[model samples]
Target: MVRTCFYDRISEKRIAAEALARQKLQEALDAPPAVIEPEPVAVVSLQPARNELTVAGLHLVMPQGFNFRDIDTTLEKHGHPVTFCAKRRPAPDELTLQRSVELYVENLRKNYPDVTIVRQSDRLLAGSPAIALDYIFTAGQERRHGRATSALINAVDGDERQWFSISTIINPAHAELADWLIEFDAMLDAIAAN
Candidate 1:
């Protein structure tokens, strides 16, 4: 359908610009969300560090005090061309919860063409609202794929308010625990602000 736009009486050019901007934004909002759900991988329990570990707004429950390794680094090291990776970022205090999550996913999509967005959603985490993004990516060196899940959580460092972006990835073929994927939610649920 053809639509007509009305501009302000003072400037037709300004009206056209505003209309164009609105159209672009509307198109983006109307675009289908890109969320890919790959076949589920087997899960295995990862040994937690004996003491609870905390980072970027997440308190990891590692009852056994097992040496802690970030999932992304482990993926980079586990084999050639196979990277099961996740990331944790200190969300700049300026961005709102949703914007931080969107920018993070958009950065991933822009930097890596192979990123497959598995899912994105919002949830209450640690008494604050959080956004979660689950996705998969292909490693060029090994021609292997890895699945990852990420969440953005709120925190406070003394009087300064802060936020964190937490993510995790796993190599399906090489993971140690059976049914390992199951614990991601539990872990996220356990996130506590320090």
Candidate 2:
């Protein structure tokens, strides 16, 4: 808990700097003076519609009171690995679902060379073929594992087909949150075609 009873105006410096940065960002967005790289998570404020969760046309019947957050890759530049990451990438029509899965897994291999996959499976998501992978890795002296779900969301846009992924890792210190894992699996199983 942070105490509000700190120093004088000097204590507000950090807050003021953050606010100024936000203002500058807004100004830049308004002017469109420079091109900004598209963020991985493009959707926002995923309001529940009819007790279902939808993002980028992918729908899921989320359970009551369950919570999930969209991952922000921008934070990775600030030294934060996206706790839950999701991304959509356009793929050629010739790419088979199995081939896409293989490509994604290969990219993960290049990124996390030390990771060891414990479980790998394929399933259907929203009526589209999908794959799930569970892997473990050592971070510092702590051993941690993560689960990821990938599905091909057919031609979400007019251009080409797209594939999406949702991956998350629970901090080893808070490993008791097994319920979160159960909810995630249930949600994945509840996916429906849009």
Candidate 3:
């Protein structure tokens, strides 16, 4: 009988211990979850600093990565390079902007047999009348995209007329083409004949 009572007491204690463990587990499962805080992020701007420079008697502003070459007649961006060239000279007699653009495209086609004109239109650059042309061509094994803007402006003294052509060329597959175009448009907007 003593052995039976001792066994009963142990079974009761075991049951009580199991019940306590289950109660503790249930309480833990019902409790709210802990939340973690997120780390802060740093903000950075993608636009580069702009600088004002004159090229081929045309005053304009360009991003800081561009370097002047060919006696300040050409501007070239270093990384993902884009080339810009400008030429100013005496206006040709009886040469209209349309004819000039046609002749320019004709010359380009002669040089690059695979040249394709993508767009051509009349536009304004820095409030001055201009003809804008966009074209694509294969140079050797790589494809190239280009834009040319031609305009006529009075000389600084306002007594003589001069014609100017500003051209830019780059690879269409460049990863930064969109950004480069934005910068290019900004530069065109800032152009002024000097």
The prediction achieving the highest lDDT against the true structure is 3
Model 3, position 154: C-alpha lDDT score: 55
Q: How well is each residue in 53-129 modelled by candidate 2, as lDDT tens digits?
A: 45668987768775333443322212333266765565677877778767867887887778888888886555566
Q: What is the C-alpha local distance difference test score of candidate 2? A: 0.64
RMSD of 1: 17.8
C-alpha lDDT score of every prediction, in listed order: 0.54, 0.64, 0.70
1-194 in candidate 1: lDDT tens per residue? 76456554447777888999999999999999889997543222221223354566898776454543444443233342333344444445576776766777788778677887777776644445567676767655532333333333333223333444455555556655324455666765665433
Instruction: Rank candidates, TM-score, best first.
Output: 3, 2, 1
Please state the error at residue 193 of candidate 3 in Å. 6.1
User: In model 1, which runs have C-alpha deviations exceeding 4 angstroms?
Assistant: 1-94, 141-158, 174-178
